[model samples]
Target: MGCVLSGLKWPRTPSKDHVTPEPLLPTLGLTPQQQQLLIETWELLKQDIAKVGVIVFIRLFETHPECKDVFFLFHDVDDLKLSKELRAHGLRVLSVVEKSVARIENVTRLEKFLFELGRSHYRYKAPPRYYQYVGIEFLSAIRPILKEKWTPEVEEVWKVLFTYICAVMKAGYQEEENKHNEKTPTMKRLEKSQATAM
Candidate 1:
């Protein structure tokens, strides 16, 4: 079921290099019925991930050129393959969430999902400030397809997703800082010396 939903392919070799970790699922705080609905929606949307990935990548590239460096760090030929894998994973996750809660009848569960997603954005190392841009781009990209179908529910889902994504990024940054602080004496000394000289 996981593989089917993720569109995973078999690797030729068992190389340990450049492994991207799977994303953590957002806690939905849902009822049993909601959980069933979520699963159904996810299953339905799994087929659309590739198209969604392309749209997301293009939109990010076009609207946030500054982010190219971060995204392109893995732009090498081999890394391109990995990038595609990562993008597909991201798209699958997004599609599941989008479809699951896009028209949820319960506002509280809906809001909870949104809040967590906003937090996840920060956790995923997305830039803290650019979430709004991403949000706008996402809405714009989907708006035409969903024209006249848009509702407050759809808007709320996006709001939550981007907000959580940004939050997740911010958390990642903080975690990075914590790691940096845990460096050995030599590294700390070097950093301190550099700071003093500057």
Candidate 2:
């Protein structure tokens, strides 16, 4: 026992890099059953994330052609050139929602995250109302995939959750709009002063 103890080495500190990821979001507004179903559904979809992403953007374009003009990435994307850019954009958007869902219990985190999303989206000048189509099209994309498991209850659950998500995002959009308006004349003056200095 004494010899074995002498040979052993133990560290006095835990590794800093071993921080645990934050636990998945709480059920929040949904019931326990609803939360379980959603988690299961997301597990299923996440397995085929790339494919679902492809389906989402494709459906978005099919349903709302005008949404294409809102993003600069879509400007050069003709019908024949859909897959590459659309797939990348689709994955990015879905990833954000996945993170939001993971932190569902943390409404503050979700709102802050999406608020930044909306604020940045202001650069695209995308109308706030247009984001509804994404929820619609994403549901349409996932419906057939979920098939037999996709019940009316599932639809209602997603509807409630996404509606909340969109509302938070819209608040973010409004914040950016307010700042933009506040900067109106100051932005012009700065530009004019820069021209004079040059």
Candidate 3:
């Protein structure tokens, strides 16, 4: 019943001294070619960003109904596809992606923006786990729109970008949550117990 590799001790590839340290902050870690691919695809995607946003959220809700509860605006609303609020919210989410792409050359700025977005999401009562789902839905939404232009390389670059974004956002959410918990220690303990019980 246990993992067979649990007792295995694989040798480290670079050894301690030769291994390069990771950056203190998350990095997009994209190569120049990947960056170019991202920019080129974004050019096509930007035009359909609004539509893509709607599609992303719609698919997300269908696949993960729990996510819909995070959005009070559309939580009780029927017909998400026809909901004006859903369309508007989707646009806002896509706008953040557009801004992140625009600031790709400026890592500090992009990270700050995404981190703040994560903090804001915490205030909106959205859990950090849901962040990854957004990225998944975003890929699903854009793949068909990009059509022939969507290659494996393009997908790789986009995944790098989302991975970076989600990491920073999750950090921000945890930070904000810690600050809130500091003021409500009892609730923090209760939440921990509830989470563990689940």
- What total of clashing residue pairs does each candidate reach? 20, 4, 0
Models ranked on lDDT: 3, 2, 1
Per-residue error for 60 in candidate 1, Å, reads 1.3
Candidate 3, residue 101: lDDT? 88
Name the regions of candidate 2 deviating beyond 4 angstroms: 1-28, 80-82, 191-198
In the range 33-134, model 2's lDDT, one tens digit per residue, is: 877777778887887787888787777777777777886677666662355877888889889769877866666787778778878778769767878888
How do the residues 74-157 of candidate 1 rate in per-residue lDDT, one tens digit apiece?
Answer: 334353334666576557546645643553555455544554554555456555576566556666656555556555655555
Ranking by TM-score: 3, 2, 1
Q: How far off is residue 64 in model 2, in Å?
A: 1.3
How far does residue 59 in candidate 3 sit from its true spot (Å)? 0.3
Pull out the clashing pairs in model 2.
Answer: 25-102, 25-104, 25-105, 26-105
For candidate 3, lDDT tens digit of each residue in 18-57?
A: 7443334677877777777888899999999889989999
For model 2, give the 10-residue run with minimal summed lDDT. 19-28
TM-score of each: 0.47, 0.76, 0.80
